[model samples]
Target: MTSVPDERFPLPEGFGPGSVWADRTGHRTLVGRTQRGVEIPIGHGEGEVNPGELLKLALIGCAGMSSDVNLSRRLGDDFAMRLWAHGTSDEADNRYLSIAEEVQLPLEGLTEKEIATVVKVFGRAVAAGCTVERSVVPGIEVTHRVLGAETDAPEEQA
Candidate 1:
């Protein structure tokens, strides 16, 4: 099968908070200026996928894309895909500590064994390649500390 043209995909040159550019087709491009800015693409989905929700979707997309790319190389263009992702995050601070997602692979013609293998391979691809998935995984340790004493007093003491 014919492969995706190298020209179709290229890495971005300069990217940081507030960086901006437009493609040859004139599509607008904006670089995140901050953590909040980092997720600007999420707004495109509006109510369906809020800005924060898009962040979750972005993770899924990243993983899904990685899997699809690998699968395509092996299975070619005949395979079709439909991906849906949903998860929760802390809007108060924009911290994401937990997430759950489902990936469906339908092989109308392939055998059950093929489907099982696809799931296994896809899971590995998602786990290994998805930035968000890797971030959520348990191996990474996080530590938080307060530089000074807590400022807020108990409501009863106040």
Candidate 2:
């Protein structure tokens, strides 16, 4: 177990989002609320969004969104983009061996040199500020703990 903090860190209230998971029928589903309080169903079934899939999604989503913002600023809002992320995990050892992301952009009007420049700028911006990409590139330290009793409370009482 990780050591308990002796003093609370100074942080803004509700700094991070929250999620709720429940068993729906036989499938496990995860739901989260947006900042506007709109519920979003993330995934269902064991295989739908297992840990590895979630990891890949976080990487791709973060990079895609960040790059989209940068690209829109540079190329205006008329361009289209597609991003894909892939990774190989050694489940037996519980580690990821490699992870890669590919981005496709429709640069219909730009010259080869301009396209290259845009790619370079996007790469630099993503490396600097994409939260998920930065977290995974060097990896992050995860700490967990068990709370409450082993058995869940009744739904009516919960």
Candidate 3:
């Protein structure tokens, strides 16, 4: 498969490394730390968000963040926006096939021209500039490395 090209973009400062670790509770709990030392707990149990859910959230969050910037510029600071994202996956293979996002705006007092402008700008922003959505659609490269050696082995019985 052909690899995607690397392109650099300017990002705001304060972005740094984040990490996640399996918790010791033995209940598939994970703890995450942000670059600025904020702790986030992720659990895979009742009333918790699992890894798959987090992936979907990342897409929606990026879409909202990126689109909102452009939308706000066009629709003014008083406009309100909401978004919903849904994904379909093949259960047997655990593969996602598609994702759809709906954008909603409260356009009660807006003119027809204003509504049209808002829709056009928001759609363009989400389609072209949503970083997470763009990245996932084209796929990203991943590399893995091992840092430790095995310490024990049991003898085989014939």
Which stretches of model 1 miss by more than 4 angstroms?
1-49, 73-75, 89-97, 139-158
Candidate 1 deviation (Cα RMSD): 15.4
- Of 1 and 2, the candidate ahead on lDDT is 2
Give the better candidate number (1 or 3) by TM-score.
Answer: 3
lDDT of 1 by residue, 21-62 (tens): 322322333222232322233233333234456555666677
Strongest candidate by TM-score: 3
Q: In order, what is each prediction's RMSD in angstroms? A: 15.4, 16.5, 18.9
| Residue pairs that clash (backbone atoms under 3 angstroms), model 3 | none
Query: Tens-digit lDDT track for model 2 on 65-100?
Result: 766777887678887767666666778978886666
Q: Using alpha carbons, what is the TM-score of model 2?
A: 0.61
lDDT of each: 0.48, 0.56, 0.55
Q: What is the model-wide C-alpha lDDT for candidate 2?
A: 0.56
* Model 3 C-alpha lDDT per residue in residues 1-158, reported as the tens digit of each score: 22221234333354434422333445678655444444456776776676667777777777678777777776677767666666656698687766655556665676767766666566566667767667776553211111111211211111
lDDT of 1 at 26: 21
Q: Candidates ranked by TM-score, best first?
A: 3, 2, 1
Q: Which candidate do you rate higher for TM-score, 2 or 3?
A: 3
Q: After superposition, how far is residue 61 of candidate 3 from its true place, in Å?
A: 1.2
Q: Report the Cα lDDT for candidate 3.
A: 0.55
